[model samples]
Target chain A: MTDLSGKRILVVEDEFLVALEAASMLAEVGATVVGPAYHPAPALQFAKTEALDAAVLDINLGTGTSESIADTLKSRGIPFIFATGYGQLAGVDPDAVVIDKPYSQAQIVAALRHVLA
Target chain B: MAVVPQKDETRALLGLTDRLYRAQGLDDVYAAALDAIAVMLDCARASILLFDDQGAMGFVAWRNLSDEYRSQVSGHSPWQRGETQAEPIFVRDVRDTGEPDWLKAALAREGIVALGFVPLMANGVVVGKFMTYFGDPHDFSAHHRELAVAIARQVGFSLERHAAEKARSEAVRDLKESGDRFRLMSEDAPIMIWIADSQGKCLHLNRMLRNFWGVPDEVGDFDFTSTLHDDDRAAVGAAMAAALRDRQSVTVKGRYRRSDGAWRVLETTARPNFSASGAFMGMIGVNVDITEREEADAHKQLLINELNHRVKNTLAVVQSVARQTFRRDGTGDLEVEAFQGRLAALAQAHNLLAAEAWQSASLEEVARRSLNGDADVRIAIRGPRVELRPKQAVTTAMALHELYTNAVKHGALRSSEGRVELSWLTAEAPRGSLVVRWLERSPQPILPPVRRGFGSTMIEQALGADLNAEVEMDFQRSGLVCTIVAQLADTVRQ
Candidate 1:
């Protein structure tokens, strides 16, 4: 198994099953998973108030976009990667790593490692 | 009667010709003709009459004639309007001739007992006449008759010349008016318009085109092709050349440079123009700017890409649900793995189809994706270029995945010396059918499965129904062979 011990990662997804799967995958690798915020309000709150090592954000929430959350993470110097079902994201940081949907645990872990490194 | 010499008569005739030559208009000509009649015929009252628009002779100019007398004798003509070869009529006494009683009474009331009528000739046809009246009953002399005919000929020729001049001037005015109207319409048109000469040189460009090219009012030698973008210039030129050669109307599109150096797509339609005599003149064309429409089409394509992304994301969510449900049921690891493998195969097919905007997917690409990085020297794949529709593409991908997995786990790859060959070709037995064969050669024969599994069921039942195909799996003493035959028309793209 891939080791992510001592890592505090924020997981943000709107779908319940996808969020549960992502959190489980992160916990299995020994990382402390933060709030799997399903909405933009809580996601922004976590980005602003929580002490974090990194974050994985689904580019879109149920009602709104995760742009504000991504912006908050950026201001705090938190390493982050974007996950999206969209082929491309508009008005986001171009340099940010993007993981396409239906991604495996291996792909997410590899991207997270690269961002953290 | 006092005798008048021929010499005096000749002088009066020459003087009448000089006055007629100096006449300015129809009124002036009539005044001169009436004067000549009185002097030549030696009469106190005289008049000039001509054909009116209604083809009746009406008095145009006269002297010393009563209105009552003129009204009673109006429209009286011995010859028709177009009659040629007629002689003059002289009535020395109205009472002695076959004259209407009303006319003779009117003439008697005006104290006119005798009169002379000389027919006017214009272009070899009699148009009207000149009349001379004498108060006294008199004898008609040949010299007096000759003088009247000579004066009538001069006045007729002069009237015809005036009519011709009037017609020519009116035609010139009408031509100028219509030309002005055409210029006004073309200049104010919203789209670019141009007129070219027979040699394809642009002779005129409307105000819109002038502003588009940033040219001056006088275009002079400006070449329209110079404004065409470099990449599209040749194609537009060829199309225009062909249209001109064939004398056919043409519509062509190309990118053109605007005055501000921005490129815009313009659709131009041109047709050959001909003169009234059917001689080829040139071409007249209009250009419509379509840059905005082009941008809108590109935006639509971007939206399609975004929609495809959303569909793939939905599929991801379903995969997550399946994983969670399978884990809670204490499902066997093998079953979960198999389900995930099937989902991945479906997604792989979607990726290929989406890349081509969901039109079709390549068969070779489907096979390679199903191999999932295990495609090595031990396995050989050979086939002609083939394309599959969306439904068949997904089914074929999943079926290939099962076959590849089975061969690796149990059949060909299970032995070091094992090899597998997968090939497809069009079948001759059934028209428009394709056959795909999977032949595995193992050093030792493998035992066939005793019971049918999900893999076989999916390959045989689902794929066969979806594609209208025939599926056969034979486990021989030598090796395993699998063949699938499907109607190309239903499952494959030609």
Candidate 2:
């Protein structure tokens, strides 16, 4: 029931296979993928400079937290959902939606739709 | 003939006896007895000598006698050893007595021409003798002899009473000094100290313990169980009681509440105190605060749990990668090999992360590890030292692997003479940006792939997206060239 056509979504994930699958899934929905930045530096850059409708962010990027990117997205009024293997992301915004790892494609698309709506 | 003592003399003798009985010490008794004897006998000097352990008489008390005379004539008693019930010896004139010449000279030097030695009998034994010396020679009277005998008896009774009193007081003083020292030591000790009676009743608490419990200094006979944690009070109390009953030592750990309502872990060790006769006296205990040590141990356990959780999550990520890799069209055994290669790359990154406590890894290390199986003669790696965060390290490792696999299959590593040049450097202009390039060279004509496969897709799309870098892949006639430029400002240490 959700239409992602023409929408540009940023995907920030560290794991290569996960990032590729997420990009492929967004492309399947006719949505344009802006990026799948692996680390916090480039993820923040894309969040600040890119034309994004929504975003999927992994809370932990292996070395440190991706909290700065989440803050940038929040400041720009861009809707996003956290993609993490962890159950709880300490210090994150309480109202932000989180999708756990090994998540199905449908779960991500549904979360993105809910936030974008 | 001598007449008996008048009524006044009888009254004075009774008063002297009363005073002797009331004397508090040996000196007081000796003074009173000497005064009474001097007045009754009307003598110039008096002295009391007691037999020492060697049966030699030593002067115990004297009145108006020269020290030299007392010392020289101390052992010159008229009676032999253990000679009790003997009549008093009255020397009307020492010049005519058949005593030793030195004894006569010593007595004469002190102007004593007459003397009387009356034995002091106590419990029908002559423990000592008292002497009365007259300055002028005079004939003895029967009444005077009776007076000497009576005075010596009173002196013997008084000496015994005074000696008993002296011994009792010395014992009392020693007991008090020992108690004071015990209290002082316990009060100044850093740890809490306490004492309980044989019946398990609290008898004493040191100043430190009193302050800890917020109790007064004089507070004793209070139940210590009230200050213990509710859950541990019963057990600790039972253990202490059992130890007391057995007259043995006990060691226990429990939580006790402080005055400010904070609970602290305390380790108590108690041992039984005993008297010289081996009677069970009481229990003495010491309590040490161990709260901080317990907290530190708990914190270490939490860190270990977190590490185990992270390891499990890493394995899950590996599983997901395998699933996605095999879920493609035309996938076969080759896909398995490629998948295993990628998994190995991930594991290498993990090893580097683990070595650094999962903080970060080095860029040159990641690249070198990914090229592990490649022929060393055909590959050259040149780079400045650069460290990457854990996420960057894993992504870069996988990207490097894809490049290496491609070079082996169709590029520089496909032939023995072929060579691959891999190098990287940091850019200061953009401040913390890194550029890494891979160039392959061979004699065979190089050709570009007709369509993008998983390898190329990962090298260009996955690496670029994950690293947030600029990826450039050019299929030149010379060979396959790949350039990756990423800012390490946020990912790497300066």
Interface RMSD of each: 2.6, 7.9
In model 1, where do residues sit more than 4 Å from their true spots? A48-53, A67-79, A87-98, A113-117, B1-303, B376-380, B413-420, B427-431, B440-445, B476-479
Tell me the spans in candidate 2 whose CA falls farther than 4 Å from its real position. Answer: A1-117, B1-17, B36-45, B50-93, B109-114, B118-128, B134-157, B160-180, B183-190, B195-226, B230-254, B265-283, B289-494
- Candidate 2 clash pair list: A38-B466
lDDT of 2 by residue, A49-114 (tens): 999999998877886678888889889999999876543422367888986554555667989999
lDDT of 1 by residue, B31-51 (tens): 888777776677779888888
DockQ scores for all the models shown? Answer: 0.31, 0.08
TM-scores for candidates 1 onward, in order: 0.53, 0.37
The number of the candidate with the highest DockQ is: 1
Name the TM-score of candidate 1.
0.53
Q: Which run of 10 residues does model 1 chain A get worst, by summed lDDT?
A: A84-93
Worst 10 residues of 2 chain B by lDDT: B304-313
